[model samples]
Target: MILGYFFILGNTNCTAQSLPFLPDELTQVLESGLPKTLPSPAETGRFKKLPAGDGFVWLAESTATLKKGNKLAFSKTFDAPLKEDDVGFVAVRCRIVDADNNANEPRPGRVLIHIGDRETLRQTALYHKGTIGREWGWYFHPFRAARSLAANTGRIRLSFDVQPQRVEIEDVRLYVAPSGFDMSRLPMMEAGYQGREPDAPWRQGADARIAKYRTAPLIVRVLDPHGSTIQQADVRIRMRRHAFGFGSTFQVRLVDDISPDAIRYRQTFEELFHALVPVPALIPQHTPHAKDGNYANQLLSDLTNTLHWAHDRRLPMRG
Candidate 1:
């Protein structure tokens, strides 16, 4: 079927996929069809309802009829092979009944999930219901596959471990992650200002210190089998400029433009990096106060312009 143009199909009521830009390889992986599960009501069974069905069986729990641990556990196995360039995610649906409810406030226990053997606190999903009631409310958690398991070759296993708190779980499921999955932020290192300026006051010879490292060549050596150096090795070097500057989130740039009078100075990263527009002007401002903030308004304007410039070319900022 032709994309971006209306076309008629043989009464099949075909609808265009939401993400038409997905890579063809990834699209093929999705088109392979998802594993089928029966619809609700018709799909009801002992295992479907939980605690009874063998299908949604518990893998581990803190306390059981025989022995109690600090938490409850459940797991399911499925065959979903992943190929290169294919992204994956997991969606889990279950109900959690926390035993600790004080005056309608739930000090619900935590739920941990593991896709395959890779697990981290980032994969945690909550099981607390706000009201003090006996209704078994369902919670749906979606997780993106970690880089290690994004591509795979074997049965996919999803395991859930709940911290000790009087809790009961039901209606557990594991499946391929779908688009628009709300994955939590992966662990990240905060960016920092690293250059002579930030250290100038404390560094006795800051310029010399900066030059010492700046002038150091990123050397590449060529050698032969006997460990003899190749004297005339042709080499080409491409180096990125070392920079020290503050970076802000794109959301901060969405504010209304600042008054021109608030700007103290204007500068551009022009040569340091490719820019789509004039760099924002710098203004003197302080914490929680935009009036006296430095570059407070200019930064916003610059970001907005930069976004427009990139959008015009249909290019992403990272790209």
Candidate 2:
């Protein structure tokens, strides 16, 4: 039937809304379909009750166990925006059923319907017996309705514990409230703050010093081909443990961004990457005459080879 008008945000660049995605509007239309012009227990047509047999009403009893011969399957269809957060929200709002103790407040049961890369139940449905209905049903967690949702729409699920015998459910509303988040308040990002300053330089291959004089040690931890911490954080020294790991020789450029406050004070790459430490913590200290262990000899050789390669290949080593 005709539901509420909800708009989906897609590449279409349009704002045309429709129904089924909105529950309140659909409920109104469904409730008003009969002679009384309002929804009553009898007025709910194909609004089908959950579970297979035992009449739709009894399906509210989540604890009601059944034999293999008798089972129930409760399914519903909806049009919701496809996204990361919405999936979790829908599962909570539309399909959680808890247990209830009418004497005081009611407890709910969990009914999760997982359909994706992994077909598994997400959570349990809780049902609390309230005066409103025989069973308290919460199919999914409530989610804020976006003013403009994504265009990729699909049906969400509210499945009964398939393994359990009795699947009970009461009243559930498939709808969302208006979202109150204000995206306009988000801070606008600035350019040149992402390593685009003119003072930036290239220092790649073999731990080369990038900056000098800082609040603390200016560490440069090298990352190997694999995703692991190859070097510890330090400065002005070659990492000892990191000797085992060597990455492609490339330029490690550094730049300074103009602080919004003033010119004398600028935010440099050193400040940005200050948290990064040179991997391998302590280096194997060696005498100048000891093989390649000589820091000066290795530095000189690496720099010479790099400069020669850059000159021969006409690469941008100096910036």
Candidate 3:
């Protein structure tokens, strides 16, 4: 399968331009305000610090093979103190290779981030292309530390838990943003793969299928009371609902509630959805006290009221 990757920074004002490609070891840090040097993991057969020829460094694992459930980790005090409520974003540029070259699919790994004593974030590291000679890909994970950080000072730890296949790691870096910083606005690299091409054979087939199945002809005829077609007339069509359902599960208790917030909730639900599924209140497990006469009667009353409310508004409900 053909595979490629592109780095996309979400900057609305800047014009699009091509960026020069750099080797994995020399990948530039895209975000500003990052520390000059991040603390590196100690050298080992499975993990080592490699120099980039420039002053920069790379934490790499190139020698020993890893097995499932194997853990590799390191800790370091930040160059500066980390304050409470600060947001941390970690960017890792790495790749995994199938050391045995016998696997049918990509392997998966987990990366965990710890600030002080509490585990702050956990993200999956999917080795989508694990074959030999595959290019490296970048992954970004973000987390926030809300509690007090007086004890840990600037200390942080990172752990990589291996899956069923052997893997390699090329680099890891952390950037600390101010509290309430929006992670979605950060620059990110977009990943591309074979089937995503606009003119791919599979895409052409999909387009043809969509055109054949998802479209229909609509003809309008305006008629008079005498059963004759009107030559000059205005015909307007307004769609009330979609042929496809768009909805979500809603709490049944909210249907009978008279509080202002509940009223707004029900109104918004009706405005947005053409159908819904009543949640826990109608589920069998939630009615465990069915043997109690009074409890059963109350539940039946609430359910009946909810059904009436839905019927009055012409809302279709599933259970």
lDDT (C-alpha) at residue 258 in model 2: 33
Each candidate's lDDT (Cα)? 0.34, 0.29, 0.48
- In model 1, what lDDT does residue 42 have? 12
Q: What C-alpha lDDT does candidate 1 achieve relative to the native structure? A: 0.34
Error of 1 at 63 (Å): 5.2
Rank list by TM-score: 3, 1, 2
For 1-319, candidate 3 gives per-residue lDDT tens digits of: 1122353211111111322232232212123222355434422224544444553433334233354323455444444434544555555555444332353433233344554532432221111221111335545544444333542344445554323333344545556665455543454344334334455457877888878997788998888999899997988898887787777777676777777767998889988887877765577734535234444565666777777887887778886
Question: Model 2: residues >4 Å from true position, as ranges?
Answer: 1-72, 86-108, 115-140, 143-152, 177-319
- Please estimate how well model 3 matches the true structure, expressed as its whole-model Cα lDDT: 0.48
The most accurate candidate by TM-score is 3
Off by over 4 Å in 1: 1-72, 83-89, 101-104, 117-134, 148-162, 177-319
- What lDDT does candidate 3 reach at residue 237? 91
> Local error of candidate 3 at 31, Å?
18
lDDT (10s digit) by residue, model 2, range 250-315 = 321111223343222213322222122111111222212422433336444544554554445334
Comparing 1 with 2 on lDDT, the higher-scoring candidate is 1
Candidate 1 lDDT over residue span 1-319, tens digit each = 2123121222111122122332222222222222234222211111122334444422123332223321223334334543221234332232334433342333333344444422332322211211111233323332334322333322333222333234334333433434443222211111222122443344757667878865765668889999999999988877553344323322224323353412211123223333222222332221123333333454655556756754664333431
